[model samples]
Target: MGNPKQKWTNEEEEALRAGVAKHGAGKWKLIQKDPEFNQYLHSRSNIDLKDKWRNMAAAVQGSREKLRPPRPRPVQDVPAVPSVPLQTPTVVPAPVIHESPADHVKDESGKDLPDAKNGPRYTELIFDALKDQNAMDISSILAYIEKMSDIPVPPNFRKPLGARLRRLVQQEKLEKVESSLYRLKTNTVETNASNQKDTWPRPHPPALYTKVGESLEEAAKTAAYKVVEAENKSSVAAEAIKELEKFSKMAEETDSILQLAKDIFDRCTTHGEILLVA
Candidate 1:
């Protein structure tokens, strides 16, 4: 564990593979014994081999699971592995030398069909073209893409190639051998492949519970009905109280008027002035 937690670069990994291929598996000491064998991983040990293989196996298994859908398995199963080296070899893109600019490449109209997008882009095509060759320049790449592309070559294709190549170099997908000459980078493809990390497994939302008798709106309606009925009763009672108070005030006013009249009458009788009235 001398290099514990240290990420293995693609060059170091390739060296390990090449070492294993040259010497054979389970003979990491033979690969480590020779320094020139592992240029990037010369300091690695047999222990490193065991750890790296474990890590790679896990990575390959995980990658396969992601890329492929689950398939039905037979009840009878036999545990087997097809030569371990076959499992880990980098898939070299098949060489694409010729191009088809025939009418079949286009649709009914002159507006040509789309170039490769979802499967593989121009960059990948260029890399595949150069895989068997030594190196290539921007002119060579442009020519290749134009020939392979449908009917009419895309406008400003040369300008885009320069920019695309520069970007590829920046992304470490391609190496600039000279000023304009480029080649597919050996170490870049495998190193940052797992850069898009998987998100954490989120717990599902908590379950909600409710009684089955009534819905939320129905329950609210029932409560509102009770409140409205109580308010209506209270309003009727309040109106009755107000009517009683008004009647009492009128009776008091009538009593005061009668007392005044009685006083007037008593004074009139004392003065000997009694009148008969209808």
Candidate 2:
């Protein structure tokens, strides 16, 4: 015997039509899975039935509109209020004050000072001094400049130096280490070289003691000792000359030979014979 066919009642059809109208079609599976709408179906064989029902409902709605009465249009009694005139505010021009050519000349204290020919600004001189020192801190650099040159730097010059330092920091020529302390920004080559690892050839373990034919380690030690001895000798000769400079008892010929020997020793011992020819 064949199984009984599922039947959809009028109430169930109306409910489904309303559901499709409310939620649109193609989601009947979701509706069927819903606990509320499950009771409306007989066997769940009508899973594709929502699409069919929606199409039928649309056709019925279209056909029924021909028999239904049309709605009446609304009547209007009140008119819109007339717009009032708007006034735009007038704009007033601002007064300008002009100053004479003499007004801008003044010293740091804001007092009227004599107009000196502005050849080089204070900031330029400070920057030049800083550059000469390779971007040293202000105090040490000022001391060095004082010792080296007769340039007089006033106390108020710090203001211009500060301004120039700020400008150099902005331009990336110098970088501040801390407040008021700065150093020159190292070039790319310098930075890269510093970052690079030392890959130069170093003496191997065997070379340190005994290699191929000769003892390289002993030879290296001897060479290093000789270089140190030569350096010490040069230092002694320099001290002797300084001692002679203080004394009045040394003979002229003796002083001349000592100076000559000192010069020869300086060239030969200090630079390890390479500078002697030069």
Candidate 3:
């Protein structure tokens, strides 16, 4: 290969800038051919000049971005009300509907029974219950409403009250605390919403849910311990089996030696008997 590429000097850079100002950007060949700047940029090809100009442009763009001011947020426009034509007002008679006599039926003593359709306002009762206190569980809230209200508490009051409580919590008028507990939002006595940042209630998981997680973690730990215990037992059994195998090999060797001794004794007895008979 030829000599390694050389770095651009101050003179070469100044000539490049002057050539670009005269001929505009992207005219690298013309800049290289220019007689006035050619002497300084003779070693740099058109490609080198193009690359250098691109790098300088990128640096200037980065500096501009850093010094740029933040854009202002746009204001929301109010919607205009539509106009209606003036008309002569007329008095209209209200429509009346006939009521069934069964609706107003009285008890055995001829006294009108209380209307079950118009039950106590659960929302107001909950707010009243939490007015003085910071928080209360479902049971305490029910008791407070019964103690304070003039009307007798219904036997099946809990179901409807629970539904109302859920609705209020969804609307952000009330907040649920730890398991079955509830409290009014901040500044709830005067305003439905508060301006404070901490007014929004943080979610609190039920004690039962937390207990379940703890139980699961404990169960996992127990299982891991059991697995370790089983592995240790298996290792002990393997060692026992190895000892038994060694004992079996020794017993086989002893039996072979005893058989060889018995055979030698019989051969000697037979040879002596033959000698005496001859």
Query: Quick one: best lDDT, which candidate?
Result: 3
The true-versus-predicted C-alpha distance at residue 214 of model 2, in Å, is 77
1 or 2: which has the higher TM-score?
1
Candidate lDDT values, in order: 0.46, 0.37, 0.47
User: Which residue pairs show backbone clashes in model 3?
Assistant: none
TM-score of each: 0.27, 0.22, 0.27
What digit string (tens of lDDT, one per residue) describes model 1 on residues 58-116?
54344434555683543121111101232223422122223323213333322222211
- What is candidate 3's CA lDDT for residue 95? 18
Error of 2 at 255 (Å): 52
Candidate 1: segments with Cα more than 4 A from true spot: 1-120, 193-278
lDDT by residue (tens digit), candidate 2, 158-263: 3234444555565566688876577766763344432211122222111100011112232333234333333333434465654344222222222222222233
lDDT of 3 by residue, 144-177 (tens): 7766653434333454456557656756788998
User: Would you list the rank order by lDDT, best first?
Assistant: 3, 1, 2
CA RMSD, predictions in order: 43.8, 44.8, 43.6
User: Between prediction 1 and prediction 3, which has the larger lDDT?
Assistant: 3
lDDT of 1: 0.46
- Segments in model 3 whose C-alpha atoms lie over 4 Å from true places: 1-114, 117-120, 187-278
